[model samples]
Target: MKTADPALQAMLRERNLRIIMPIASILAALGLWEFLVWYNDVPHYLIPAPSLIAKTLIQDWATLAQSAWFTVKLTLLSLSLAIAGGVLLGMLFALSRTVEISLFPFAVILQVTPVVAIAPLILIYVESTFWALLICAWIVAFFPILSNTAIGLRSADHNLRDMFRLYQATPWQRLRYLLIPSALPYFMAALKIAGGLALIGAVVAEFVAGTAGQNTGLASRILESSFRNEIPRMFAALFLVSVLGIIIFLTTSWLSRAVLGHWHESEIKREL
Candidate 1:
């Protein structure tokens, strides 16, 4: 039988350690938190132990799950709209200096203006609460994608660009062969950032809307829990929000790796 290579074994060990360490650390931290809360006889209202939070989550899962689904839908819808708008505008900006000069400042202004400040106005004007919330979320998520994509499209290697020009490449040929690949890395990075921002925007919009009902999102659930002084339920809702953000981040990261792992330096793992 052939012996396994020591380097391969070492690499496997390193990969396993990377995964194990974070899980171990989180478990340890939660254990410590639980012990301290128990030892102090802390009121659940002040700081619920992880166990209590978990129990609350289970107890309230029916209501919370519906709210979670609502929040998820809001986030996804806004993100989709942001992506469509940003990429199309980014492409237009890349293709036309006049358009970029005229419109880029407006994008910058929107980005600098706090969403909270405008959300109220949006809510007031938009007839549909859901559409208003989506607009708010889309505004928050759009800029990063537009900025990154524009930069990426412009970042195609000048040497390769010259070669394409020298060969009299068609516009579509140049875009497909050169520009799109260059823009992909930037787009993926922006996606990770925009994913989180979309969730935040959705939550913030929900808070602003403050529409209370069975159709409400997690933010509304949190608000209701706070109003009732149901601290554990509030914590549970907060936990769900955090979990959703983590899920979005992980999903975007996985997409980045799937798309760019083979060729992109940022995604490629180098053996040391």
Candidate 2:
């Protein structure tokens, strides 16, 4: 690779410097937070100090870690199912206008219905808590993937479609060679949006279902912490939730770039 020009290097360094300053500012704010709490002699139960929050994070690390892991599992598993089912259904819709017209209304209904409302019904009908939670999360996360993938599948260039038709490309060949690549950017976009939604869904579902022993997740930990008035522990769980969200966002971004950076406008990197 060509070395960056010195002026460009300096500009890049300055840009990164701009990013670093905000992080420093946040840390400074936290330090100020610790000081103010001390200065006011604030009760820990009311608003825990940063130091106490850190300490509680360490003290209750084991249970918090397990709960975080459970939440992660539900998010991952539900996201996987969402992508699989949505993409398959989207492909069916894409290939046949008849199917799209017939089934799209149902898809819209499912997508529109609030998962909070659905969770209770799912809990009653689904014997296992795990399955119910999965269903709820999947319901919330699947729509974006389905809608975006369907659009992507139909978004192939008209010339390319004509070429495929002229070549008598089989359905599988069209899918493998043309449709999937065309849909990738859309899928990635949907994944980024749905990644956060999946997390929200999992947590919301857990909150509604009360996280029975087998279904324990971060929502349970957060609720339990709040009920017990363990402010620091609540903050710690919240910190973990924020970290999980950041990880998911970053992971999906990286995956989008890796998959579509070479071609798609959505994921392409621009020259400075």
TM-score of each: 0.96, 0.93
Residue 262, candidate 2: Cα error in Å is: 1.5
Off by over 4 Å in 2: 1-4, 11-15
lDDT of 1 by residue, 38-90 (tens): 99999988999999999999999999999999999999999999999999999
lDDT of predicted model 2: 0.92
User: Model 2, range 151-196, lDDT digits (tens) per residue?
Assistant: 9999999899899999999989999999898888889999999999
What overall lDDT goes with each candidate model? Answer: 0.95, 0.92
* Backbone clash numbers for all candidates listed: 0, 0
All-Cα superposition RMSD per candidate:
1.4, 2.5
Worst 10 residues of 2 by lDDT: 263-272
Best by TM-score: 1
